[model samples]
Target: ILEQCYNLMDFEAVAKNTMKKTAWAYYSSGADDEITMRENHSAFHKIWFRPRILVDVEKIDFSTTMLGTKCDIPFYVTATALGKLGNPEGEVVLTRAAKKHNVVQMIPTLASCSFDEIMDAAEGDQVQWMQLYVNKDRAITKKIVQHAESRGCKGLFITVDAPQLGRREKDMRSKFTDVGSSVQNGDSTDNSQGAARAISSFIDPALSWKDIPWFQSITKMPIILKGVQRVEDVIRAIEAGVQGVVLSNHGGRQLDFARSGVEVLAEVMPVLRERNWEDRIEIYIDGGVRRATDIIKALCLGAKGVGIGRPFLYSMSAYGQPGVDRAMQLLKDEMEMNMRLIGCSSVDQLNPTLVDTRGLSMHTTGVPSDTLGLSIYDPLVN
Candidate 1:
């Protein structure tokens, strides 16, 4: 099964069979009914491509810079917690794979491996970023941020969406218990709690817009809000003096019916263009991005890059670092082929004219049959 895996979705199928039920539920489940989870992938189908012919796309350049670092592709690994649950080597496996492929890997706040351990795993000039889950103790948050900066982390991606962990019923049903007290907060050390609740107890629910300035005062690393869903917040993010934003819903794990990041991108791009602030702040998105076409669509609508979380985790779970390396290679091949087919020679050439977004915001009845995402959330089947 591992050798048969070619794409991220194949890895996902293999991972379901390889991983423990509790770990699989924790990684795959979204909030409540998971309507938004399914929507994230299906939303891509709503967008139709307007490919141009007779254009010379013989020499295509898929390389793009993200947060001042150049990546070989337009997609990078997003932060997903508890990597050791997927593989014993944990986030270190991802670090090795990212370095091998010249892509960035965002280290999660709740990673099974320590911050320095993940950093130490990197070889050569590999660029890494830290995903911050703000602690209730501001002093602790400051210390973590400064430490990451000292260790050569490129950016600080602060997760802003989860004021409280959403109701992920699949995890609740599994009754998955967290292994140890991951964070040093004096909170409940009870291991009986589910994965989300146990690890997230240290996160400060009181986090607000006013705290952004304090974060700016702490470290010089670029601050990107990781869970922005509203257009008005993007305006606030620009005014708040942050470097960038990742339009995401915590991979649909935070808010059940929250709009997909791609859908939010569709809404926010026009507003940013109208305000003449589209290029002022770097924009990235993550949620239900499975295919190369999904990444291309995001770039066309003005994303500096796209983040993929679960797929990479699944790949690592099924086949370790080699699985991740293979997944990246497959995406690169797909993007290069699609670039020629779409009549674009480079990432910058992807524009609004290349996509049709008329059906993006419209409500649909059932899950579209074309996507594998819908079945992922169906507990009875998996």
Candidate 2:
């Protein structure tokens, strides 16, 4: 199986076959109908590349920085909940892989491993960001923030989209009950927590723009909003003095018909460039990112980097650390090849002139939902 694996979709197939039913459902399923989830990847098809020829493409470099944290690649392992559900080692396995690869890992607030457990797993001073879901109690939120700063978390990414977890029907149907379902490894999942919603209540819906200042005063970590969806929000994020914004829709698990992150990026970047504020804040997008071509498309359209969640989760769930290792390595190989083929030599060379976004808004609808093919096809794109 390891030798057979090629890309993210291959790992998804392995994960589907290997993961426990409940875990598979939670990791793979999206919101109602999953139109946005599938569209997340399909939206990339809309962008066409205008590859140039005869450039010095022998040595391709995709290394770059995010929020001032330099990484070996232009992507990071984005935050996702519940690692123990698929692997016994939990998020530490991910931490180890991230360290091995020298890319940033955004530790999830709802991780099965304790926050310190994840931080402690890092090799001395590896760049790790904290993905915070604001606790309803300000005191608890403050404590989490201060502790992350103490642990030397380099970036503070406040998730602003999901005030409430969406109705992930597949996860709901697959929720474990009784015996082992009550909890696993004695982590945060306590019955409903184990099932899903118990921790959802811990997140405060009242988190607002006014709260940004409070977050700033508490920690010196660069503050980034992770779910800004519109051009206006990106502008507001710049004005708010945050370090960056991730133009994401929570991997299309929040709203059923929400726009994909890349689509939103097409809308947001022009506004930033128009206002001469592109440099004011680092902009990124996640969701439907599967291939190196997707990464190039994003970079060409002006993203600092991308946040990838499920592919790594799928790889880790199926083959553990080695699976993750190969997944990232495959990306590096493809990134280099794509960069060479596209006639660019470095991360700094990617620009809007290299791609076309005229069809970004032409959302493809009425595509048939193949149940088995859904598992075999890209987990993100139906």
Candidate 3:
């Protein structure tokens, strides 16, 4: 009845009314002011597609690989914890959907289901990546990474933005709690720590570039540092010897009024190219990718792929598995259609030249070709 009761658009409304108000707040609220959250969506609007006709795209394909793993599309189901709050099946249902879609599933450190349970649900049929939070103790962090590696998890994504949790006033006001939940693997689903208290409990806010090797020594799986917003940080990540970077601001769930992910993408990509690490490491963006066009825009700006969090959550909250499936299909369809319309036969062909960024300030001067201690040539769009 619930599945039939909601369409993709109606998922959020249904979830909000049916799910606990506090859980909804935790899942939906952004950082203070949500200024960046609002801007993340708006930045996509600022990019206009210059779709070219005369191209024969009788059949469109949305198949691509992320960081050497093949997928039905370019997007991944981002790691979010305590999905049981949204639906009884919890991460199991989400794992099944990602397995079915042939994409990646990031299992959060705060997952309500234990790693063993989530892996059992995966059934060795899909790629699962572990998302890490710097726990209060380095020993615990290493233990989680080792566990993930032992379980055949393909990669590790260390989310660095929340060394301390940000001020999510909405969630605080809504008063969410996970007291009754099983709290799998001794996970802390409560945000009572806030961002600061939470990180303070675990990761040292003073964590530095020197610590990257500390994590590297733990496992051979690829490491992707998420929440990289600055070029200097990007350089630090590269120096850290990680395999990839996911330019994000935690879906604007961390810092308020921070630069949207796209804005950061434009800045970081050139640095990668100039540093001669453009293809050396996988680069991805994930803040405001709500549509296929948004995905294409990121590719044009030089991202290997994009990670989508809230939109899929919105779908899951709205209609469970079916909503999740429908949302993935919509994004894939949009990407394929936009690619064909823009005369690009494949995702690989997408670049800054395919779309016009004439009105944006950064485009007024062409983007720099060299990034390290050198002047970059910012291009002018006519």
The local distance difference test score of each candidate is 0.86, 0.84, 0.73
For 103-181, candidate 1 gives per-residue lDDT tens digits of 9999999888888899999987899999999999899999999999999999999999999989888887887765463
Stretches of candidate 2 off by over 4 Å are: 178-194, 363-382
- What is the Cα root-mean-square deviation between model 2 and the actual structure? 7.5
Query: Model 2, range 346-376, lDDT digits (tens) per residue?
Result: 9999999999877874442222222212122
lDDT of 3 by residue, 97-141 (tens): 788778788887766677888888896658888988777678888
Best by lDDT: 1
Name the regions of candidate 1 deviating beyond 4 angstroms: 181-188, 363-382
Q: How close to the true structure is residue 258 of candidate 2, measured as C-alpha lDDT?
A: 85
lDDT of 3: 0.73
Better of 1 and 3 by TM-score: 1
